[model samples]
Target: MKKYTDEFKLECVELITIQGYPVRQAAEAMEVGYSTLQKWVRQYREEQVGITPKASAITNEQKRIQELEKQVKQLESDNNLLKKASAFFAIEMNKGGKSR
Candidate 1:
């Protein structure tokens, strides 16, 4: 597999995204695989809306945003678990009191 620089990836993505070139056309002109260029364009669009890629990000700002978004998702999951546990414990305490 060939390794392309981040700058190269961005330019390829821009050809399809910003410059309105077809993915197939851009890929052919750039000598990149069609699927690969398509993936780059998809990642670029997703990053614009804060959807992080599983692979390396296209931009530095997007990388940071992806990190933060992951952190936020983890925190939210933890909070939800804590809320459920608290509710369960409260219900248990009430059951014990009522049984006494």
Candidate 2:
């Protein structure tokens, strides 16, 4: 396998993480393997978090947990909106019943 410079690896990781390019797209544009770019990103994040590079890896489970947490926040917001709507409709119904 060909070796890459640390600078090149950091550029590739920045393209995906900072520039918002997808990993596959960044890898293809940089002429590197997709999995190689992903590993770089994981390492970059580990370093940012002050973890030993070799000892830290972000697992798929962690990604899933992040996604699930976002979904839960969205659901909670929706439930609150529904509760407000229900209360509004209940008041309307009471008003109409009294008028009849």
Candidate 3:
């Protein structure tokens, strides 16, 4: 694997977390793998939140927790979309029923 400098890694993480660049866009601009950039961002967040033991230390459990958090976020987003779609269809159905 190609090694990246600490400063470079921090800058990339900052681009996503602090500078408001999307992860994928930053990764593309940096010419790094998308997953690699994501891992760096996760590590940065863990450090910022005090979940990580150190800058270079991440336990398997911490990794699992991060993965679970991502899943929960995705599920919540999906639920919101579904709820909106259901409400929209319900409104349309009510309009049709009123016209019948």
Candidate 4:
């Protein structure tokens, strides 16, 4: 499967919803699958109404939330790693001092 950017997906949805383009016609013009464009439109509509999608986000706000959530997860993982390393080095230092 090909990955489409959030901007591209939003533009395609706008072409159909805002620009008065038929879903099938827009799909053909944009070289995307008809069903894919249709799905994007549906998701766009749902997002506008404050629905949080289970799949990848279609709107800018949701996309930012997803990005931030990913960053938070990464930071948490790095923090855990750093804590472990600190504890390991502290133990090593204590052992070395005791042996001197």
Candidate 2 — worst ten consecutive residues by lDDT sum? 53-62
The true-versus-predicted C-alpha distance at residue 54 of model 2, in Å, is 3.1
Local distance difference test, candidate 2 = 0.79
lDDT (tens digit, per residue) of candidate 1 on 1-100:
9999888999999887789999999999999999999888888888888777888899777888877888999999999999999999999999999998
Ranking 2 against 3 by TM-score, winner: 2
lDDT of each: 0.90, 0.79, 0.81, 0.91
List TM-score per model, in order. Answer: 0.63, 0.53, 0.52, 0.70
Q: How many angstroms is residue 85 displaced in model 4 relative to the true structure, after the best TM-score fit?
A: 0.9
Q: In each prediction, how many residue pairs overlap at the backbone (N, C-alpha, C within less than 3 A)?
A: 0, 0, 0, 0
**Candidate 2 local lDDT, 1-100, one digit each (tens):** 8888766887898897889999999999999999888888988787666454433234344445556767999999999999999999999999999998
Candidate 3 residue-wise lDDT, 1-100, digit = tens? 9988867888888898889999999999999999999988888777667584444534356556667777999999999999999999999999999998
Among the numbered candidates, top TM-score falls to 4
Candidate number with greatest lDDT: 4
Model 2: CA > 4 A from native: 55-100
TM-score of 1: 0.63
- Looking at model 1, report the run of 10 residues with the lowest lDDT sum: 59-68
As for lDDT, the candidate ahead, 3 or 4, is 4
Alpha carbon lDDT at 68, candidate 3: 77
